[model samples]
Target: MVTPVRVVIALCLLAPFVAMLWVGSYAKVDPVFIGIPFFYWYQMLWVPLSAALTVTAYKLWQRDRRGRVAAAPASSGASPKGGASE
Candidate 1:
């Protein structure tokens, strides 16, 4: 059941958590952005980035759910190999 779309969705949702949790990567004062420190700016940047990623994941989830829902009836309606009884 591990599909490519599910993998992409997991990555999208995991990115922000990984980016924020890895403090050493952005724990700096140099490369200031319009007076804001790199640390602050980097963290703030993820706000929108996280939102976008979450939206993307949600849309993908909905699409995947729809596909599964559509396929469910077709799968369940089938008769056994011995055929159905009248």
Candidate 2:
């Protein structure tokens, strides 16, 4: 079942890709940032943005994986010794 948390994680991973891929949106030289052209500065801004988004996605994935593992049921016949022989 797809959960809200999974949807959020997907957005986190997709945001940077969508922003960076849409080059034409920030292809202008106006709205300069600290003397840097919008074209260059815009792309540079995503460097940090992408890193933060990627970290968030990774952390969310780890949390989800841990939750799944914890919720799994153990085998009924399994022994504490893992069925090992003396």
Candidate 3:
């Protein structure tokens, strides 16, 4: 929710995508597997990696949410009528 935390989360999410692009662009890494090109294999590895990253991000988000909820102060008896000023 905080600025730096949000930036870190964004970077974490984008890292695998950048890695995928970098690996996919390589034209010279050879040695085919099951008739597929080496380039395909290398890029395909990101499938599971992406999934792992998603799980990691989800876990991190959950922990962040829990921490925020725990740290939040209890609601007072009287609620504010409308939006608050920054």
Best candidate according to lDDT: 1
Looking at candidate 2, the ten consecutive residues that score lowest on lDDT are: 77-86
TM-score of each: 0.83, 0.80, 0.65
lDDT of 1: 0.90
How well does candidate 2 score on lDDT at residue 28?
A: 98
TM-score of 1: 0.83
- Report the C-alpha lDDT of model 2 over 1-86, residue by residue, as the tens digit: 79887998999999988988898898899998899999999899899998998899899988987776566556454334346334
lDDT of each: 0.90, 0.83, 0.70
Model 3 misplacement above 4 A: 1-7, 23-25, 31-36, 76-86
Evaluated against the true structure, the overall lDDT of model 2 is 0.83
Off by over 4 Å in 1: 75-86
How accurate locally is residue 56 in candidate 3, as Cα lDDT from 0 to 100? 79
